[model samples]
Target: MFMNSPVPSSIGGIKSLARQIKHATGASHAAALDSAAQTARFQNYAHAQRMLAVHVAATPLADARSDLYPLFLTFYWKDKESGERGRETLTIQLSAAWTSLITAQQLAHNRSLYDLQPMASDHLEGKHYCSGQMEAREHACAAARVFQFMDATRLRPSASYSRVYPSGNSRNCIPHSDHPSVWFDPATRRYLFVDEPYKRAIGEREEQERERWAISHLQVIAKATWRGMYNPLQQSGSQIYFISHAFSGVPVKPLVAAVDGIPLCTADHWAGESATATPRFNSPLAGQPIPKAKPVPRARMQHDDPARPPLTFHREAGLLLNKLISLCRRRAGIKTHLESVRDVLREFLMRTSAEEDVSDAEVLAIYEISNTSVKPILRPDWPQRSALEEDMRKLRGLLLQEFAFKAYGGALARHLGAAERSLGVWH
Candidate 1:
C-alpha cells in the first residue's frame, strides 16, 4: 500500500484506496476508511473530508517537508573517581519537529550536553562520585520542552490561533524571538543555537573548552515512506534517528554494538566486562521525594467578570494603542491630529500596566479621550485634511471593540455604548 506512497488527491481516489485496503486486510469498510485516512495523516475519514473540502487538492496532505519524526538520543558518561562508566538514552518525539535532520541532530546533542553537564559535575570536576542515570535523563527531558523543542511554547501566539499542547509555564518559558543568545537568521529562518559537530573548528580560538557529544553512530531502524524513521521495538515512531555519541574532552569508552538495533552489552565494548557493576556513588536526589510542580495562578479570568477583565483585552488594547502610535509617527498626516492620537494612546498605556486588569474607570477615561482628543483628529472635514483619516478610522474600530467589553457593565457600559453610537460606531 505504501508503494510510491502517493496520497489520494481526490475523494474518488480515496474511496478506491479504501476498497483496496478492505480487500487486502479483510477489515470492515469503516476500518478501511480510517486506515486510508492515516495515509493522509488525518484522524479519521470525517476529519480528512472536512479538511479536504476546504483546502482542496492544493493542500498539503502528507508532504515530507511538513512531517515530523521521532528522535532517539543516547549519551555515554564515565566518572573517574570510582571508575564508573555508564550509558543512557532518551527519546524526544518533539525533536523530530525540526525538519532538517542535520540541524535536529546538532540541537539534540547540544541541548543534552547543556542539561547534563551540571548533573554530571563529577566528570568535569574530577570528583570521586558518579551521577544517577535516571535523574540526569529526567532533568534533560524537562529542560528540552522549554528551549530545544518546538511547539506552542516556542511559537508566538496569533490572535485566533489554538494549540493542541498546553502552553508551557510562562515563568520558565522564553519565546524563541526573545531568547538572549540563540542566533536566528530572519532571511533564511534558521536557528544557529548549537554548533555543528560534523564540521571541524577553523581555528584554535574557535575550539570550545567545554565537553560535548558527537554523533558517532546513527541509523533508522525502520524506514517509513515518509522522510523520518521509527523504532517498532520501543513502540516509537517519528523522523526518529537512533543516535549514539561518545563523550569527548574526558576519556570515556564509547558503547559499541554489532548493529544499530542490537542491544549493547559488556561484551560489545573492548573495555572490561563490568557493565553490570554498581557505581560507587548514588544520585543526590535519588531517595528524595520528587517535588510537585506548583500550580500556576490564573493571570486573567475566563468569564468577563467586571472585577477581572480577560487578559486578552488588555493585550489587544495595548497593541491597538501601539499601532495607532506607529501610524501617527508617519508624520504625513496633520501634525495636531497625529499628535493628539499619539498622546491619548501614550496616556492610556501609562495609566494601565500590561500586567493589571483594566478597570471600568480606566476604560471610561480612555474612551472619553478617544472622543475628545482623537475624534476631532479623525474628522473628514478637519482643516488641512489628515492623511491618517483611514488609519484612524480603523484604529477607532479596534478601540470601540476593546471598550465594548461586558466586564465594564451597568452605567459605564451604557455610557460607552452611547458614546460609540455618537461616533457612528454600531454595537
Candidate 2:
C-alpha cells in the first residue's frame, strides 16, 4: 500500500480499510501490523492532498511568471548534530498523500511558505502569499505559531508578536526584508536560495556556496530516505527528507506523516494551532516578574520523527545481543566471568554510535572468562582442549586491530561464532 497507491479520503472509508485489513485472517501473524499500516496509509493521503491545495510562495520568475511546484510531502529529520531534528535519517513515503491528484487540485489553497515574513524585497516585490478563502485567522500573511511549529529548531523564538506581549506593536519585529530566508521552489525545480535579497546579506560567493550546500543536503537527505527509516512508534515504512535550511540558522523539513493520528508540524507547532495557543511569556508592566496565566488546554500530538533512534534493525540486534549475553552468563556459571562478559557486551554496543571501539585486552579477557567458565564442563580430554584452543582462535578474530579506532564488531556479527551460536534468533 505505497508508492502512488490509491487511498480512501473519507474517515469512514479509511477506518473501513483498516478494519478489513485487521479482519483478513489470511495474514494472521501480522494482522495488527497490517491494520496500523493501513490506517497510516489513509491519513497520509489526506495530508498530501492538503499540500497540493496549498501554495508555497517561492521566488517569482524574473520574467514576471508565476513559479510554484505541486509540493510532494515527504518526512525528514535532523541529527542532534545540526541543532535540528537534522543530521539524521530522512524519509519520503512512496504514497503521494492523495488518492487522486485531480481531487487535491480542487481543494482550497490554505498556506504559503517562506513568504510569511513582514515584507518582500524589490527582487520579489510584487510576489504575494495566499491565505486562501479563510480570512478570520489570516494576519500579516503569517502567524507566529505557524512559523515556530513549522520548524522546531529553525526560527529564533519570540521574534514574532506574542499573545503575552499583545500590547506591544509590530515595530519590535525585525523583518526578513533585510535578509530573506531561502527555500526550494518546486515550480522552477531549482534551489531558490539565490535571489537578489539573499545576495545582499551574504556576498555573491557565499550565496552560491549556500545554494551548493542546500543541493548537497537535498541529495544527502534523499539518499538516507531511500536507505529507509522505521518509525518505532508507527511501525511503518517511512523516510524523512531534510528539505530546506535557512541562512538564518532556521532548518526546515516539510513532510506529511501523522504521529498518533495527529499531523506533525515540521515547526514547533502543529497545523491549525495558533501562536496564541501558547504565547510567549508576557513581561511585567515594570521590572517585576510577570504573572503566569493558566495554560490553555489543547490536544497534544504524539510526534513520530522518522529521524529518531535506535533504528529498527539495530535495536532488534541489540535486543538479540542482550538475550545472547543473558544466556551466556546463565551457562558460564562463574559470577565474575559473567560480569566481565556483561561489560564486553555493553562496550561493544557503544560502537553503534561510531565513536568508540572494542579493545584487544577486553576481548582477550572475555575469551579467558569464557574459557574459565567452560573448562569445568569439559571431559578433560584432547577433544576438550582442542575445542578450547579453537574457541580462543575465534575470539581473536573478534578483536581486529582496526576495531581499536572505531565501533566494535558487535554481538550481531556472524563471526561472533561460538559465543552467539546457540542464541540464534532466540530473542
Candidate 3:
C-alpha cells in the first residue's frame, strides 16, 4: 500500500505508520523504514532521506511547547563502597498521555535511549541520563515493582566452589560462556529469565588473592509501552531525553515465592559486608503481571560546598572564554593573543574535565578534516546576540565574587570586554 506522496510531517506520525507496516507485513525496523519510504514513492529508505529535509520553520520536537507524558524507570540499590543507600529514576517522554500505549511500547523496544545500559562505575550508571526528581510515594511504588519482580523469579545460584581465573578480574566481565541473568531476547520478543547467578563475587589468586563483588541488592525494573527511533538522525532533530539511574536500599515488598526453602527479602536495608545476603534479580518476564508500586524515599541533592560553582557554571564560563579565543584566532594582528587565553581557559576547563583544550588552529584543522567550512566570525543572529549578552551579565553577577573565579576571571573579563567592543556580542 502506498502512503501519499509526502511522508508524515512529524516523527510520531512516521513511527505510527511504520508500526502498521511492521504489523501487516512482519517486517524488520529497517525493512519497515524502506517500506515506509516506498509508500511515498521513494526507491528505498536512503533514497527517501536524500529527497527529504527537516522542515526548519517547524519547531523541533524538543522545543515543542506541549505536555509530554514521560516513561520513567527507577532502580534501587545499596552503595557498595560508601554503604550509602539511595534511589534513582530515569525518564523518557513518549507521548502526550499514558494511553498512547502502542507508540510508547514501540519506542521502549527499539530506541537506544530507552535501554538502561548498566555499567560498573563509582558514579551513577554510566548510561544513566541527567538526575531527576519524583514524589516519595512514586519512588516507593517503582521500587516495589522491581522488588516483586525479583521475588517471583528464581536466579541460578552461584557455584559453591569454582576455579578462579586470572582474566575474570573486571567487575563487569561476564564469563565467556555465561549469559546475563536478565536479557532481552529479540527472537522471542520477550525478556527471558533463567536460573543463574545474577551477580557474584570471586577470589582471584593471580598477583594477589582478593574478593571482588558487584553491586549488591541491585534490582532493575524497566517498564515501557513500545520502542523504535530514527537511528540515522539520532543526534540531528531527535527528541533530547534526560537519562539517569539511582542505587539505594531495596524497597520493601511482600514475599511472592521462594527458591528452594529460603525466602526472598526485599526490605529497605543496606547490604552489609557480606555477599551471601544480596538478593539476585531477573528482568520482567513475558506474560507476567506488573505488581502495583508503593512508596520509597524522595530524591535528594548531593551535598556540595557553597563556595564551588556547579558544572553548568563552569560550562557557561567556558562558552564566553571560547568566544574570546575564537575572536583572537580570527584576526591576524591579534593571533598572538590567542595562546594566553587558550592556556588559561584550557587549564580552568580541564580542571573539572568539563571541556576540552583544543587550540584555534586545531579547530580549523578539524573543520578541514571533516570537510566542513569554518564558520564566519559572526553570523546574522546566529548565536542570539541578546542571549549571549544576558548570559554574560548573569555569569558576571554570579561568578565575579567567587574566590575560584577571581584567579582567572579578571583576565577573561578584560578579553570579553575587548571582544564586545570589536565583535559587538556583549553590550
Cα-based lDDT for every prediction: 0.33, 0.28, 0.32
lDDT of 2 by residue, 356-420 (tens): 35455543443233333332332225564454444433333333211211233333122343343
- The candidate maximizing TM-score is 1
- Say which prediction, candidate 2 or candidate 3, comes out ahead on TM-score: 3
> Per-prediction RMSD in angstroms?
23.2, 23.5, 25.8
Question: In model 2, what is the error at residue 231, expressed in angstroms?
Answer: 26
Error at 370, model 1, angstroms: 13
lDDT of 3 by residue, 1-427 (tens): 6345345533444556778888888989988876665454333455334323222234565333232222333444454555644454333222222222222232233222233332211011213322222222233233322222222221111221111111223342322212222222122222322211112222233102111111110112221111111111222211111101112211111111121211111112211111221243222232344322222222322212234344455555555545534543454323333345445544554444434444555433321223224353444364656654554454343343332113454564454345444445322
What TM-score goes with each of the models? 0.25, 0.18, 0.19
Residue 214 lDDT in model 2?
36
Of the pair 1 and 3, which is ahead by TM-score?
1
For candidate 2, which ten residues in a row score worst on lDDT?
117-126
**Poorly placed runs, candidate 1 (over 4 Å):** 1-68, 95-135, 146-148, 151-427
User: How does model 3 fare in lDDT?
Assistant: 0.32
